[model samples]
Target: MGGAFVAAALLARLGGRIGLPTIPLFILAGILLGPNTPGFVLVADPHDLEMLSALGLVLLLFYLGLEFHMDDLKQGGRRMALAGGTYLLLNVGAGLAFGFLTGWGTREALVLAGVLGISSSAIVTKILVDLGRVGSPETKPILGIIVVEDVFLAVYLAILQPLLSGTNGPGDAALKAAKALAFLLLLAAAARYGTKIIGRLFDTRDNELLVISFLGAAVLVAGVSEWFGVADAIGAFMVGLMLGSTTSAKRIMTLVHPLRDAFGAIFFFAFGLSIDPGDLPSVAGPVAIAVALTIVMNVLAGLATAKMYDFGRGPAGRVATTLLARGEFALILATMAASAGLNPRLSPFIAGYVLVLAVLGPLAAGRSDWLARVRPGEPQPELVGAGK
Candidate 1:
């Protein structure tokens, strides 16, 4: 753990000096020091970091929830839905079409649809914080789209399970989907009506006790969520949401910063450790095309979101680029594919595609102004809190 911390921090610091995002640098540190590459191996087994990495993911989303107030939800409710729906229609539809074009078969197409469709909530949350855009005008929609995708993921995975696992029947798939829906609704209800009750539960002045209560609740809820077949990250987020409305929200957020930063770095590092650079080459061409497709689709989606919210080019670019990274969830799909014995190339394609965008997402977001400058257009009204 010490070695992982040192390596990640050192690389991130070095990269920070050069104006690079710490995210990709942390991943690069893992790739360079991991056993997959020829060099000093800091950690021979990525599994050693798995639990910590999962905690990192949980904490990241939990922090995101803390920042996303209910007022934002009420204000952007309809527009958020429309923006999220537009994003899904463009990206998921394109992914399915691209999957079929690859001629990898139906199962592969189904998997690819998810891989290409969902944005990495973990990465997106990190970008929002790193770029200081968490409070930006477009962030509400960006997060709303992520929430929408989480719901879609539950249903998509339910559909994919029977086809891939062979053991799960349509009945099993329906049950899983139902469980996911129930879990989300349960969380939503808690966030809506149980805020005061939740506040009372964690209302304490002791710093140590406060940390223990919130951390335990977040992780426990996240674990329960996974058992119920929903994304653990979503579970963590909802936990944060419920707690964010509490009187202790500010205190909890203050305490969580260090934990979120530390664990989040490990999450990215573990992600890099799992990927073998050699595998990326074989699927480079396909990955390139897929990355291009994601970028183009995201741009269209961003424009649609901008139009809906009356945002100008800068905010639209920020919207597109901020949501660009694909990480943990894509890897989850890759693991499922490998276990199901689908196309072998699918794994590498996902790896290469994720790595490129993971790196590119932060880089692009940092320079979103460049996107705004593309083909200079007529002056437009800028939305409040939308500037870079």
Candidate 2:
């Protein structure tokens, strides 16, 4: 594991020098080193690596939530909600249509919709950082879309877990959905209202105390989320949101950066670790089909979202390309589907789609400006440099 991290760090540095994103490089390394690649740096116990990968996911989301600012939310206001809602309907609809056309059953189609709809928040957030786009005007709405996406994801899982367990009927599924929705509402309320106590807890400049407090809070919240059957990444994100409401958000962000980088790499690598190379070629056709459809829909989603919100072409392109990748959540859906025996072929299809998109997604986002300008007779907009 230690060697894995060291190798990941070296790969990341090399990728950086070549203007490549680390998200794909990390996963590519995992593929090269995973158990599937016998005689390589094989992960002997993938189950154990998965547990740590879960941790990596939690911390990665926590750090992302920390990057969001209240000002952005407040400033973007209603446009964020409108854009996010529209984006969801469009993308999810595209997924469902694709699934049905491919002859999947209703439930399987819905699962496929989920696999295609959600963007890789961890990878996308990392792209924002690597491209120095965090504080940009376009980012506010993108983050808003992510917030909405997470909420929908929780609801999807609420219904999915029971669906996999074989719910008695639609009413039973509705009840579970209600419970999940209630939990999400309560979690939001707590984060929104419980700022004073949290603010005072680590208001002092004691590095040791602050570190312990933040880490412990993340763990406690994530553990509680697991207890409630919610995704731990969502739980950690909420914790980060609560912390973001406080004055110490900046301090926490600075402190958490190093940890996020290290663990985040592991998270991406572990994602690749779970893939079975033998299963991929068989599913390549479906993977390519899904990827092609998603790319078109994602671009449309971004364009429509930006136009509706009155954003410029530059921002619209950013939204479209940034969303081209699907990641951890999609894998979770695939894993659950495989375990429930829904379809023997779903997992490989998803893994291949996600793996390909992770690489293409970042590259697309990094060059969004150029992609947007590919339109005839349209002059490309100038990119504002970082910190400008």
Candidate 3:
């Protein structure tokens, strides 16, 4: 922990001068101090660390929800739907094609495609925040699309879990889908009404009470999701979204930011520690393939979303560029896949791929403005017309 803190501080202090994101530094520190390197050996019990990481992830999602509003989603829903739908289709199609060409079985191919189709919202959101672009017009649509995509990915995983686990047949898959849909509907209704009641129940001036209430709600929803055999991350995220629409969302976020940051650091550090350096080279080929596909798919999805919203080339390109980074969700998916017995060989590959992208994704997003400015054409209306 001390080493991690020192490294994080050094990176934060010097990262800007060196053109590196602070996150990559933290990751690199983890690799160096992890079992992979000789710097230090800190291996906490996996179950305990994962529980801590899970808490970090929950808080991260909660903050994401605070940034969201029903009106924003409603306004951008069409474009988000278009971008998310097309992106998933392309990713799954391409992943399936790759699997078939590689001689994988149908079920295995489907699982691979499903895993690849989803991008990491947690990573993308964090990158945007780091770059201070979260409030930018270009950022809004990208985030909106991610919000929609997250919902879809959650639903997809819910269905895929049973099938992959051999715990359910096709009929059961249908039932699971129905249950997932019902859960979404119930969540939406709760967001529309439940948040208001909760807000009234916990006065904003009572910060401790508000925080406790917010966390309690998050845990309750997460428990509900687990009870229904869905991923807890989905439940946490949905609860956040619902709470985000409330008047108290901002306060909730402010109260939780410090706790979120501390635990979130632990979460990412744990992710780094979990990686085995010995296996990295062996998995490099697959990781490379996965990273390349992530970049391509994210860009394409961004462009498609931009075009759907009638955004010009610059904004579209910027949005697409910004969406390139992968983080928490990717890890979550990989972890889930490993547990589900997808392929032992694939786990490290996916982890390595996520780590690579987590670093590169932000670099790409950070440079998006420079890229946009140098593009040959009329500047984007959103960029040029702003403050006019």
**Best candidate, lDDT:** 1
What tens digits encode model 2's per-residue C-alpha lDDT throughout 1-388?
A: 7977987888888988876667767876787788887776667556767767767777876876676544655666788878888888888888888778767576778789898888878778778888788877778778888877876776677566656655668898777666656676787787778788878886979988898899888878887775555666767877887888799999999998888878778877876776677888998888888899888888778887777766666777788888787887787677567656786667667778887898888888877875465433444344433122
Best by TM-score: 2
lDDT against the true structure, per candidate, is 0.82, 0.76, 0.67
- Error (Å) of candidate 3 at residue 298 is 3.9
Model 1 misplaced stretches (Cα beyond 4 Å): 103-111, 120-167, 310-315, 327-347, 366-388
Per-residue lDDT over 12-38 for candidate 3, one digit per residue giving the tens place of the 0 to 100 score? 568658555555555555666676666
Question: Residue 94 of model 3: what lDDT?
Answer: 74
Q: Give the CA lDDT, 0 to 100, for residue 114 in model 1.
A: 89
Please provide, for model 1 over 1-388, each residue's C-alpha lDDT reduced to its tens digit, 9 standing for 90 to 100: 8999999999888877865666667778888888889979999999999899889888987987887676764676888878888999999999999999999988899889889998987678778887798878788889888877765665566456546754467687677767777877888899999999999999999999999999999999998887776667778988988998899999999999999999988987887787787877888888999999999999999888888988888888899998888876786677668768998789768877877897888878877776676625775465333434
Root mean square deviation (Cα) for candidate 2: 3.5
Error of 2 at 140 (Å): 4.5
- List residue ranges in candidate 2 displaced over 4 A: 69-73, 100-108, 126-140, 158-172, 309-315, 332-344, 369-388
Which sequence of candidate numbers ranks them by TM-score, best first? 2, 1, 3
Give me the displacement of residue 316 in model 2, in angstroms.
Answer: 4.0
Q: TM-scores of all models? A: 0.83, 0.85, 0.82
Clashes of each: 0, 0, 0
